[model samples]
Target: MPLLTINLNPAVDTVCRVKSFNTHHVNRAYEVVKTAGGKGNNVARIARSAGEEVYSLCFLGGASGAWIAKQLTESGIYPVSVEVGEDTRTCIAVVDERDNSVTELLEPGPVISQEQQNRLLDKLLDLLRSKTFDCITLSGSLPKGLTNEWLDQLFAELCSHDIPFIVDTSDSRVLDLLHHKPTVIKPNVQELESWMGTAIREENDMIQAGYDLCRKGAKAAVVSRGEKGLLAIRKECIYKVSVPKVNPVSTVGAGDALVAGLALGFINQLPWPEILRKSAGFGTAATLSYTTGRIDSGSLPSLVNQVTIKKIQPV
Candidate 1:
């Protein structure tokens, strides 16, 4: 079964490496770079690179949107998209050489028309009806003008078919998805804190929150802690997964790859231990590269072998 990716909010990625970046100063700097990106698009790219068949569903418009479709197709991603009225959103990433700080300029996604949004949803369901998929991944933010009804209806379809879902989102919408019991949910440390409404100072507290999330309709929960490794709760147990330390060249898109790895593992029926290990390895490998949302396959296998996932009972 192929992996199906739904990207309601797509982006055009522009990255530049600036030396001694200064604000309010006309900075003469590195060459500007652009790439096809968005959370779901990146996940599909990583999943396909891992030797999985992927179908990408998104919204694109205008010349930039046309270029995005061109890039996705050229890169071998199957684009199932609908045309909208406005241009697609763009994000600018600046890498500071002095301290390796990356400043991000993210534009809110273009407002999707009601008709186009409905048609895209219809297209997604039609594709799902025509092809059976190993898993379904919903990544990134919901665009403006898309209502909760839209997401809820989509979740209903997933539930009716018993297709497992893995979602990466942060908002009140998450509270609604809980009723649908998504197969998996990945939240970073800060997002977890926001949901928990308390400071998570220690390992035990993190584990407690992971369990709470599972109890709240997530079949399995994974919380990513930068530089601290990942905490996973599944099979009525929690585990801490770590990898050989790498001085990360970039932190962008690491979480998306991590979720992709987890989704891929679930599709392959990999054991829980290996799934967690692969999740950590994919993330580490992604950061090993300097570019945003790019993970080289050559670095994954070796990194996978070095990751260790320890089964633990929270103290």
Candidate 2:
């Protein structure tokens, strides 16, 4: 079965490398890379690289939108795009080589009109009726002009389907949608803290936060903690996943990579421990690549082996 990824607010991501970035000064980039980017799109790309058939459903407009579609097609991902009125957004990430720090400038993407929103929903529904997907991932921020009702309808429709879906986003509104009971909810440590409105300073705090999400409505919560690896929580058990340290090239899409791994695991019905190992492996491999949403595929096996998974007592 194929993976279907939905990116409502997609972008053309531009990554520039600078020796030492100084604000308020002209710093010429020594290297630049551009790729079709959006959290969902990244998941699609990584899953495709892992030999999974992937479909990317996204909103596109103008030249940037066309470019993104083209990139996806070239990447072996089938594109199911809905045309919008305004151009898609372009996000820039400046990587400062001095300390490997990244500075990001993100544009508010095109405002999706009511008509466009309906069209996207209709397209998605039609696709769901026509094709069967192993897993569907809804990722990234909601585009401007989308109303809460629109999201409600989207989630309602998704829930009506039998296929499992994962939600990976930074928007706090995810808390509001937990009642829909997505198969999994993925949030980074910072995103989880923001949603819970509390700092997670200790391992217990992190486990408690995961439990809170599950208690509220999420069937499962996978919290990504940069180099510390991941904390995966379910109603029955919790897991502490750790990956070996590596010199990172960019951490931009590591979370998305992890989501892709999880999707793949669910698709294949892998054991829970194997799932976390694969997910963390992909995330760690992503840190070895400079591209926004890609991972070093060759390093995945070794990384997966190096991943340490331990069952943690729920707080």
Model number with the top lDDT: 2
* Tens digits of per-residue lDDT for model 1, 235-265: 5688888877887767888998898898888
Reference-based TM-score, model 1? 0.95
The estimated TM-scores of all candidates read 0.95, 0.98
Worst-scoring 10-residue span by lDDT in model 2? 156-165
lDDT, each prediction: 0.83, 0.90
**Which runs of model 1 end up more than 4 angstroms from their true locations?**
none
Q: How far does residue 191 in candidate 2 sit from its true spot (Å)?
A: 0.9
- Candidate 2 — which pairs collide? none
Cα misplacement distance, residue 262 of candidate 1 (Å): 1.0
Show the lowest summed lDDT stretch of 10 residues, model 1.
170-179
lDDT of 2: 0.90
lDDT of residue 22 for candidate 2 = 99
lDDT of predicted model 1: 0.83
